[model samples]
Target: MLEHWSSSEVDPSIRLDYWRDVAHNWVDVQPLSPGDALEASWSLLRGENCFFGTKRSTAYEMRTSPRHVPPGEDMVVISLLEAGEMRLNAAPGEHQHATAGMLGLYAPRQEACYHWGEGARQTYVALPRSVVLAALGREPGNLLLTPQRCALAPALAAQLAHLGLLARQPGRVSAVEYAGLLDATRALALLTLRNLGRQGEAADLPDLEENLHAGRHAAALRFMEQHAHRQGLDAAVIARGAGCSRTRLYEAFAAQGQTVMGALRELRLQRARAFVEHSPRLHVGALSWRCGFADPSDFSKLFRARFGLSPTEWHRRVWMEPALRRGA
Candidate 1:
């Protein structure tokens, strides 16, 4: 399960006293000194996972606004302007103003701040330096802003909205579910952020080249899908079949926020799941071997860890599905 924190039911004086530990159990929350920051973070998280910039009756101030986070520290904030005007000032004298239906990224690592207009209700998600680096796949601490016009902006905004609702109504969701949602949202945000960086940034591509690369990647994925059933299919074989070096293959898929090994595991587990879900009578030991595990015990452990159910138990549940029932 993904780990997460909800602001609801938190003590009013959270960071000041006993509530500090409260944040750590579910989320990481540390008030930054003038120059300290978590780094570029995911907007789907709040408090510890990310910082926030919203206004109450009095003006709310964030690390941005005439603040420079220096070289190493960073606090990347995502703001969804529900109903208000906000201005962000960044280095190189870049600034943005909001009117309606807009999403903004404020890089506080390099001298930036958000100015909340009068009576504005803006939701902010601050990500740490580590999260930003993970998403960008590079160290870019300055200002990286992608407005709502981008393809993934809408989805990010929607996720932010969902998270906002959860923060307001934390009781409705179980801690387990909340953790999963946070993980999903964070993963989605990273993927979107990476895509946004590449979109319209590369040289004009030949249609043929684009098609060719797409086909290659697709073929590689297809090959992995088929051979994921074979435990012997390691990175070396995949690289050879994909017609790329191990490093190149890794780089290509890593752009999609997935590693070579992770794809193989996910594909294997997924196919095995399909098999068991279809054949309820399949024994765990046999299914594990068939799914590429040399050891049945290891297979059971992994299956339980991945799907949160033992193979036998999972088969029972899988057969319970109406579609699989027809076969049963």
Candidate 2:
């Protein structure tokens, strides 16, 4: 679902209070120019493990503190400036300016302040701290990257904009598809961090060969997860997409106590389960083919084996069991 909040509809006198309430839900913020005519619009797209959104507003100064962060919700926000500029204070005596086509990283539980220029427009992605660290292999302090310094900045900005576009069209995406998109987005972010040399520990980093192997392995997994629904998808295809040899791909999965085909099957099953849970009305046969299962009977058998029930039975349990229990 896409949620929108704007101050244009509220009374002029109460606009500040209304905007404060809306901003407080995401972070601690106080409008610096409360007396001025304030206008803002926020569009949010929520997912299972991450969110992408956009904010367009007039000039304001905002701050985030430990007291404002929600309990147990550690998030890092990657912001891309589409227009105007922002003066950011991520730490004491440290400041940076994020202008158009630039990116900024905001860490969790860190106190930061931003002074947004008039008509500032920014797009952002918020993911859990664990996700960000897992992708980057290091803690990301507040960092800023420019297109001139980082070759991947333009690509990263494009991906962020694409995510925002996807968020706006909710009717065209399913839960499983959205998860695939998120996986792709994460892979791009990891690539961007690598290209920027921001993964940290250049001196103590592993040998080049080892690091390259690890990166290729992660890339293969991400590719398989994103394209699991494609027919005839296998290790060879994954290897080609990940820029590695088929043997190297097999070795990578073998190190994890699994095979390439095994991982592909698992990804397919995960997608099937997501569809079953979120789209209960979808027919089992259609869902089977949608998830890349060649045969409906085979899909049903595997679904039963993995989930302890046939597809129809599982759907009924998920959708109907609660109502029956409530009646009791």
What candidate 2 gets wrong by more than 4 Å, as runs, is: 21-26, 90-94, 147-151, 165-183, 194-328
Give a tens-digit lDDT track for model 1, residues 206-238.
Answer: 366445545555556877866766778888898
Error of 1 at 30 (Å): 20
Q: Give residue 290's lDDT in candidate 2 (0 to 100).
A: 90
Q: Model 2 over residues 1-328: C-alpha lDDT tens digits?
A: 5677888888878876777776545466655332456789877767777777887888777786777778777888888888898877522122366777778777846777877877888888788888777766777667775564457868888988777676656677776776677767767776776665553445334577656666766788788877887878978899999988999888766644457887777678768877887884869878888988888899999888755578888778777876787999
Q: Supply the global lDDT for candidate 2.
A: 0.73
Error of 1 at 147 (Å): 6.3
Provide the lowest-lDDT 10-residue window in model 1. 33-42
**Superposing all C-alpha atoms, what RMSD in Å does each candidate have to the true structure?**
19.2, 20.3
lDDT for 131 (candidate 2): 72
In terms of lDDT, the poorest run of 10 residues in model 2 is 89-98
